[model samples]
Target: MVQDAASGDVVAAGTSGEKKPGFFARIVIFFRQVIAELRKVVTPTRSELLKFTAVVLGFVVVMMALVYGLDYLFSWVTTVVFGVPA
Candidate 1:
């Protein structure tokens, strides 16, 4: 038996009693489910979107700075160990 998550209702009794849907019916069902799920999505408000974008950009900038510092540190370490390349 399959239980519906959203409504907390039993959707199917048992697989033994029911015949499987045909290929086209299955396709239709899949599209219907996709549409249903899409309907549940919440769109961010303009302010919320801007805030999220700013946060993401800030995070990326911080990550880039960290990587750049690491690369610079490694380069310096290699230079010190190997002596300056000719």
Candidate 2:
């Protein structure tokens, strides 16, 4: 017996006499909700798009450099431990 927090109304989980919507009715409801959500989307301007792209590319480049340095350091450590000739 769950109750709505705002309205203090008892939430009916298929217990009430009301019947759930049919398959097609649910499909219509789904599209309505999707359209409502799509309306909230904001398209970035050209300047904002360029800034976002530059930030993402800069982050990727920094990550690649970090990974390369770590790989080189680990390879050197492993070589020293196993006495592998480099």
Candidate 3:
């Protein structure tokens, strides 16, 4: 048997005499910890958020242009190989 350093409560190491926390008790404990953690979250300001959104939109637009260029190049090559219709 070991005593908790701060609380001085006796804690058993193994399953011999320990009572398990119930399911609902575990869920409540989990939510309490989540709320405590969320309280520490820092949200981005409006300017920072706008900058991130712009960067993402720019990247998507560049990717779309690249894909369209590749598609057009392939279509032109296929027409040349198979011969274009008169």
Please report the candidate that would top TM-score against the real structure.
1
Alpha-carbon runs more than 4 Å astray in model 1: 1-14
lDDT of model 2 at position 8: 86
In candidate 2, what residue range of length 10 has the lowest lDDT sum?
Answer: 12-21
Report the C-alpha lDDT of model 2 over 3-73, residue by residue, as the tens digit: 55678899875665466788999899889989999999999999999999999999999999999999999
Quote the lDDT for 66 in model 2: 100
Locate the minimum summed-lDDT window of 10 residues in model 1: 11-20
* TM-score between model 2 and native: 0.78
Clashing pairs in 2: none
lDDT of 1 by residue, 1-86 (tens): 55556688877645346666789998998899999999999999999999999999999999999999999999999999998968
What is the C-alpha local distance difference test score of each model?
0.88, 0.88, 0.87
Q: Residue-wise lDDT of candidate 3 within 1-86, one digit each (tens)?
A: 54566787877744345566789987997899899999999999999999999999999999999999999999999999999888
The clash count for each model shown is 0, 0, 0
lDDT-sorted candidate list, best first: 1, 2, 3
* lDDT of model 3, residue 52: 97
Better of 2 and 3 by lDDT: 2
